[model samples]
Target: MSSLKKDVCNPYFSHIYIEKDVLKHPVTKKILSLFPNAQSLVINHYKDIFCRKNQNFSLQKQTPGLILARKHDNLVYEGAPVCQNFGNQHFYYTSSVMNCIYDCEYCYLKGMYPSANIVIFVNLEEIFKEVKGILARHPVYLCVSYDTDLLALEQVLGYTKEWIRFTAEHRDLTIEIRTKSANKKVLDEVRPDKNVVFAWTLSPEKITVDFEKHTPAFEERLSCIQAAVKKGFQVRLCFDPLIYCRDWKEQYRNMFQRVFSCIRADEIKDVSLGVFRIPQDYLKRMRKQAPASAVLQFPYENDKGVYHYHKDLTEEMISFSYELVRKKLPMEKIFLWEKTKEEK
Candidate 1:
């Protein structure tokens, strides 16, 4: 069985939920064709299943259902305050999918949604239409894979390929598809376009093994990053949500050495740095789901509505990682997320 199949309790997507409105949509049909063995049910709306109360997020993750639905309104949204804008004035993000395949302990999705099932919005053309409208007014830097790892599900959904093709036609639209996926086959399948950036979020091997459950190992992710750079794809390396640990400095230093050794610093588009921070309400939900997670149980300081590591520690982590990266790449290529101060 495939690694992904092994990660889940049952075969991948044993049960599929289809919103009745999109049952006849071509995108839905294509997905259904790929999973003929999957038992699917048609429902009036995706929320009926996705937002239902009292769903056990952890239990359902082992055998998570797939939901095919149409996104009606608010196809594009201004970037969230917690997210790094990377100096883009017209930054925005759109979620073609609702949840992720990998269940990282530090993930905000656990608190953002009520269910663990993956939801794929089958209406890409509608989303593209909205993006074009924004591009007409000013250049748009959009994050297409914000809510889910689109590249990880590329074989099943093929949304990443579609986004690459769409980007080729629009000079003013630059889209970033961030993922922890180590699927190198995607590099061969999709042609590289300058307007499309493939951002990989990497962590230390220890963190990958302990906290980032079911994600690619540190070496696997690094290998994929090398593959992406060789294919001439615009690659961005994200060290964001930097997990705090007793030996984080040693781990991060070693990771930086391995990364720069495999690929030249000039080849990278840019690097981003951030310590773990999540909305307060999301952390509350996460604690309820995984009460024993060390990463979750940490006494994080509440900066406004966001919970994160203490200020001194957060600065120390980012500065240490930033200095290591600066040795290889110029300061212009580094983007770090910092906290804003408010009267206490």
Candidate 2:
């Protein structure tokens, strides 16, 4: 039996509550020890922390810890990117966990939060109920694992597994778990649901190695996606925030070829393309955090509060990449996320 199947039997975590009851399980106690100063926030069925604002790189690198907070059952949009993309359609997203384990330099988390502590919202059932209510009105697409990679922390939190079970029961609901984790253990334990899409944000090998610090290698991520496809999971490809690199076209062409070669076209559900863009405030914070990073120093055009590549260059990249990917995937299966004029 896997360690996950074994009942959480630990004593140090006796003060932690799952729903309302304080859990004395040994494993839970061990996990709690990682954050000794955290306060238990119990809001309705969910319990987590109300973390302090400005948790950017400077604060997190000093004392990396976890925050415990309960998410309000009524609220859905948890983090940044709140107004863009699906936010317009009233599509809901809830983060049971906050602060990712990986340390990608391009990640907005560096600018968004002042700390690196992982915040876990314990009241999951209430969130599920809220989701059910939302889905009753119209077919909903929910993006899970956005703020954090749920699969990487699956052994510690089991929230991803619970989500799998929840989405499996609700066919009207579409759940997308976007991740960079290469953990295959979590995938093996849970069967795939047709309504759930396991989306992986992929980059070129050079970019993955150089820019995405501490993340899984490009090949490893591809292998994980391949495994998920074999398990009957609907997989989506995201070549988002395409980094501008030397020999950029060749790099992207090789990446697309490598991706299609590993996974069949029929197994893929869809592909989303978006060039790198960040809010002005976040970019300022990120620049302060890493003064030497070329990614931060690159000349960017500020459209409103967000910063992105120049319009002409960004559009060209998007068009070229989308065209290349479309050759491998059907037109209906391709989704392009670019900034429109009104968005500027």
Candidate 3:
């Protein structure tokens, strides 16, 4: 165990929660190796700890635990109305991992999950088989990392690499691994695939520092995207969930300038744009978690079951963003969020 002492547990989690059923999984073993310094406790199921009642979400978020278990049910789900389907025939997302390392004030995970601890499904082969079974009948468009920043955990999990290889073998499967991580080592470890789209969510430096706690800086994230473009990867930029802040226009304008300064606009596969929006229930839960956060206090109109900027501001924000990026990339390559026909 002396050599194990040298293993620094990702510096994010204080403990590793391992389900008794997955204790021997190779992926679980690999994850344990990375967090050798962390306390390991055995449990019958991940939800036993992950879904415990009265867990303090905010406090747990400061020192989240890592839970390794097998995903028994609901391996995949249809992409929600809040997400961009990218005109795919069959769009779906999987929560192979739950929760994230970063603590963004606007994150919806706090509302979706009962705990802030991260849960990783150790059974990769089962997920692959399930995906393959679906692909046998129809071409599938899957979002592999919607619920968590899988790429940020790539150093330990390596599931992103597995997905990359899986997609390379299955010609009919297309995947989007959306992330805000600046870790570029994973980029060099796997072969770039045309079927895989690497999407990075960008935020203004001020917003990032203020609302997005413990995430990579704007410059760092840009460097990683530049590296990906240079390596011939299908890199996509997601300005989705764009938060409104003081001097947002000037800040976003500078952000756009900084983004194009590193890579040619033509090199980007596509750009997605959307202003901040969340389900009404999720906003209610988030409000309870962080009462003082100005983001939660914003006068977001409750339209149907969703809470978002009022109609006029929503139009102005999206239109202003489109006009700004229009200078760098062709309008054809831009994807805008379409509101529900009746705002229902």
For all candidates in order, the CA lDDT equals: 0.91, 0.73, 0.87
What RMSD, rounded to one decimal, does every model reach?
A: 3.0, 7.0, 4.6
Model 2 per-residue lDDT at 43: 32
What does candidate 3 score on TM?
Answer: 0.94
> Best-fitting candidate, measured by TM-score?
1
What does candidate 3's lDDT look like per residue over 236-269, in tens digits? 9999888888788898888888888887988889
TM-score, every prediction: 0.95, 0.82, 0.94
Question: Per-residue lDDT for 277 in model 3?
Answer: 87
Instruction: Between candidates 1 and 2, name the one with more favorable TM-score.
Output: 1
The local distance difference test score of model 3 is 0.87
The regions of model 1 sitting more than 4 angstroms off are 1-9, 340-344
What C-alpha lDDT, on a 0 to 100 scale, does residue 291 get in candidate 3?
83
- Give candidate 3 misplaced runs (Cα > 4 Å): 1-11, 340-344
Cα lDDT tens digits, model 1, 263-293, are 9987889999888999999999999888888
Looking at model 3, residue 215 earns an lDDT score of: 92
